[model samples]
Target: MITSEVIWLTGASTGIGRSLAIKLASCGNTVIASARNQQALEQLAAEYNNIIPLAFDVTRQDSIELMQQQLSNYSGHLDRVIVNAGTCEYLDIDTPDWDMMRRVMTVNYFGAINTVAAAIPLLEASPRPHMIAIVSLATLAPFPRAEAYGSSKAAMQYFFDSLRIDLVSKNIDVTVINPGFVKTPLTDKNNFSMPFLMSSEQAAERMVKAIAARPRQFDFPRRLKWLLKVLGFIRALWNKIIAS
Candidate 1:
């Protein structure tokens, strides 16, 4: 059980983030939960004494600044910052919404980067500073119509991976989580088949346990990871499966 840490979690209104907030708070961590949805966050806080709701949109700089202020008001330092806030929008080649590319990238990529930037100072104050990002296995291989989502996570994967090396001097650990399909409101929008999909609660459970070890990277639901690994070798077959 990871205990007694001050954890700041974004995207905590629902799905994996909400589950994670409850799980961590149950383990004796003080959770500062951030999301655009204030009422949902309040509902979560009502259920958990340790969970403090701090609602803010990650994509907005002003919102991020306000988050930093609220975080400062809560604690002097943060042991970990989890960037789980994200959005997904599939593309249509026949008639694409060109602006969607920007929207998805803003939330998943720049928003994540901005959120992390705001917490770096507080993280540095901790004896064991750790940064965790909820990236996706979508980055491992291509999928039909996931152009924006895949590209954003791909950018996050590389950014955090590179950041791990750079942060070594400060002894800050970075753990990147690459999860396969997890059942959530976000994934519920998918019209295609999602093999080996698991519940958000289950995913959050796995994440909490695995992240305790602070590995350089953690990929879950081993079966999916292996499938992707095998598929990576046969591009034609992989393409056919996803394209179908």
Candidate 2:
């Protein structure tokens, strides 16, 4: 029985974030959606009275501050902050450009950190504050050409895990969501096969349920989760298997 809670969702312009925003808002939560795409955000707001658009680039600290200001206009504490905003870029071994890694890290790592930092104060104001980050399942096992994407998500996994420990006494709960291949715009660009790919709606449903449980970690699709765990324990085997 998840009650209506104030939620701040990033990367809500499309894909998983957009679906999650709609799901949460429809369930009676006051959802504030953020992204650089104003038109998309506007469309989301138009669909639901509870969905408010807060457009900003997550990469900019000033933009995060401005979003915080806009949030103040709502005059309510956020029970949950979902930092779902991220970017993925597979590395081209032939080209071997560090810029590719930088692009992924800037959005996937630094951008998420900035959003959390700005939201912390507002989250602290709530009686039950929860923070969620949508990371990648690629962190569980090394994949070919995912050098940049994997490293960024791995960093985020570490960051959120550490934050969870530090915020324990403060009563601020943090959950790290590791999603397997989902059929989102982000994954649509992948040239390789994405096993057990779920739809955005399915991913959103799973995420919302997991967040309701407020677990320290949430990995979707039981079979995929088991496979990653087994592979994780046998790194050498996985390296050979994936590299093959």
Candidate 3:
């Protein structure tokens, strides 16, 4: 029932990005799916002829430039760009891999910037271009060991929020999507409990619905969002809970 459009989706090889690619393609969209794993992207594209696999690492300039060339040659325009490429690394204060901060920021924050840089010209060519990125609810409330991951998403949220203002003149809409816990390869690595964890399919369905609305921001699962909001409002209570 969704209208067909051209969409470029990052992190298409796994997790929520992969799920979103499938859902979008099923809805009749032509999806350019990107990821580090060429084989996985190829397999995903095989399942859906509408999908075109473009393999590259988000953190590397050379990789991003190569994909930019591919985009230029493949299509003159992109109706939407979905940046779901990111990595999460928890910080262990006691024995922290200080470099993990750099690694996470490089992909989650700077990587998204690189994607937008490549896609902006294409987006401008479309009649109604939309930019979307998958951020995390972790930014709403500080969680133990999430120093690195949460900060990256927080940066992403602000970047796009500001970018939305600048792109309005170009008629390009920017949407920042904040999702709570979802079962995926990335969250599978989490050692702590993830409240209200939902299936990636469910998350994708919600996202697609929100995308149709073209909201400037979309936060899923109202209950979890409220819970985080409440925690964020009470620093003392949040501090005590996480300290234990």
Candidate 4:
């Protein structure tokens, strides 16, 4: 269990982020919950004394600098920063809205960069600083209608891996989380069936315990990872089946 540390978590207004905030706070950790939804964050804060709501919009101009300033109001040093804010949109193969790609990239790719930029300064102050981001299992292999989301998360996986090297001298560790699928309001909108669909609370619980060792990368649950690997190995057959 991760305890007694100040954790700055984005996307905390809902889904896995919300569950993570509750779990972390309950373990006697100070959780800085950030999201654009102020009312939702406020409600979460009211329920957990260890939570502090800091509503933020990643697409705003100079967001990194602004976020750093806003975060300083909560704590001086951050032991961990969970870059979880994300958005998804499925493309219509017949008439894809090209603009939707930009929206997802802005939030998932550049937004992650901005978040890391803002957190690094504060993280440097901590004796044991760690950075974690929620990338996706889609990066393991291509998926239909996931061009934008998958590409963005794939970019994040690369970014974090590269950043891990850069931050080595600074004594900060980076961990990337690739979750298969979790039940959330967002995923509820999905038209396709999700394999090994875990609950947000369950995912959150596992994540907290897993990140304690600060491994370079982690993927779950074991069954989904296994399935993705098996599917990747048989890409030719999988492609023929998925082409419909």
User: What residue runs in model 3 are displaced by over 4 Å at the alpha carbon?
Assistant: none
- Tens-digit lDDT track of model 1 for 1-244: 7999999999999999999999999999999999999999999999999999988788997666667788999999999999999999999999999899899999999989988888998999999999999999888788888999999999999999999999999888999999999999999999888989999999999999988999989998889888888897799999987777
Note the clash tally of each candidate. 0, 0, 0, 0
Any runs in candidate 2 off by more than 4 Å, and if so which? none
lDDT per prediction? 0.92, 0.89, 0.91, 0.92
Highest lDDT among the candidates is held by which one?
1
Q: For model 2, how does the per-residue alpha-carbon lDDT over 11-103 read when each residue is reduced to its tens digit? A: 999999999999998899999899989999999899899998988788897676777778878845789999999888877788888888999
Model 2 lDDT at residue 84: 94
Q: Model 3, 60-149: lDDT tens per residue?
A: 876666677799787889999999999998888989899999999999999999999889989999999999989988899988888889
Residue range 75-175, candidate 4, lDDT tens digits: 89999999999999999999989999999999999888888888999999999999999999888878899999999999999999999999999999999
Q: List the residue pairs that clash in candidate 1.
A: none
Model 3 Cα shift for residue 164 (angstroms): 0.6
TM-score for each of the candidates: 0.97, 0.96, 0.97, 0.98
